[model samples]
Target: MFGLPRNRILKKKKDFQAVYSRGKSYANRFLVLYVFRSNGFQGKVGFAAGKKLGNAVKRNRVKRLLRESYRMNQGAIKEGVSLLFVGRKAAVDAGCQDLEKAFLALAKKAGIMAGDVEFSIEKRKNCR
Candidate 1:
């Protein structure tokens, strides 16, 4: 949708571990983001929500929100990179717009994403 194209999502255990171990991390109100450059043609994005966030349902809901946000905002991402978004407990109760803002904010801060992206969520609240 929009100008964002279909890109592969990161799913391998090794990849996740590498991102956690090697990438630089940035924290926001809703999520902890880790970014790494990869050898692929497109960027790979992953989401992780621990049990501390809540039960499976709650965790999955946070992941789903992140996934949707990432999908819509993928056009800002560069190719051949790996990004991992580890959900914070606060994300379990966050709205999609809020979470999207937090994710993009973190990405921008990390310098992996360039230019200003006017997302659907306009009002920037206390989203770190």
Candidate 2:
């Protein structure tokens, strides 16, 4: 029923801490991305939206948007990596497309995306 399995989600607090401590980070207006190379073949992802963003509903909404953006664009991301996406307060006002753009831009800046491919969200929409 689910495309992304449980293993693909970074669930442990230690894991998040490790990524935060060891990983490199990149940020835009919407989100902050922390990327760390992993030993596994598949990438693992985690999302964070703080209380500062708002109440639980608002935070969850931000998380949902971030997750959807990641799920859609995960194909273009490099394998063997751990990614943590922390949504900013501005993200509460951002749409999915804006979040996706922010995500991809940060991933590219972190050098975790393949350079040979042209990673454009617009092109991806037409292909689908």
Candidate 3:
């Protein structure tokens, strides 16, 4: 299962709205990230893939990829913040590694990730 727990997820519409309206945002080719400092000690996250992305399957896949990327890099993220990731239409065709890199880049730019940690994706060469 995805490592994100219930307490770590931003579930309500109001929470999402707050992040969207008041939080600082950053984007890359595949994703848009909204980050808000919160009163709580732990970070909370939400993933959104709009209808324009495609059918339910496509949207879910995009969301799953975003969640997985966040889950993988959760440790380096700063506490007391809520993060919301919105997937771009191009994300539907992207691989997980691409999404992960984009997510980490945006998070780092937003100053959410710790400074000492390095987040990088390994390149895979196609074998003929």
TM-score top scorer = 3
- In terms of lDDT, the poorest run of 10 residues in model 2 is 119-128
How would you encode candidate 1's per-residue C-alpha lDDT over 1-128 as one tens digit per residue? 44333446667798789888888899977999998876751477778999999999999899888887887777887666788889998898888888888988888788877566565665534232
Candidates 1 and 2 compared: the better one by lDDT is 2
- What order do candidates take by TM-score, descending? 3, 2, 1
Residues 1-128, model 3: lDDT tens digits: 23678787888898889888988989988999998897852478889999999999999999988888888788888878888999998899998888988988888788888777975566534200
Q: Rate residue 50 of model 1 by lDDT.
A: 94
Number of clashes in model 1?
0
Give the clash count for each candidate.
Answer: 0, 0, 0
Which residue ranges in model 2 land beyond 4 Å of their true spot? 40-42, 120-128
Q: Candidate 3: give the clashing pairs.
A: none
TM-score per prediction, in order, is 0.84, 0.87, 0.89
**Model-by-model lDDT, in order?**
0.79, 0.82, 0.84
CA shift at 86, candidate 1, in angstroms?
Answer: 0.6
What is the C-alpha local distance difference test score of candidate 3? 0.84
Q: Rate residue 78 of model 2 by lDDT.
A: 79
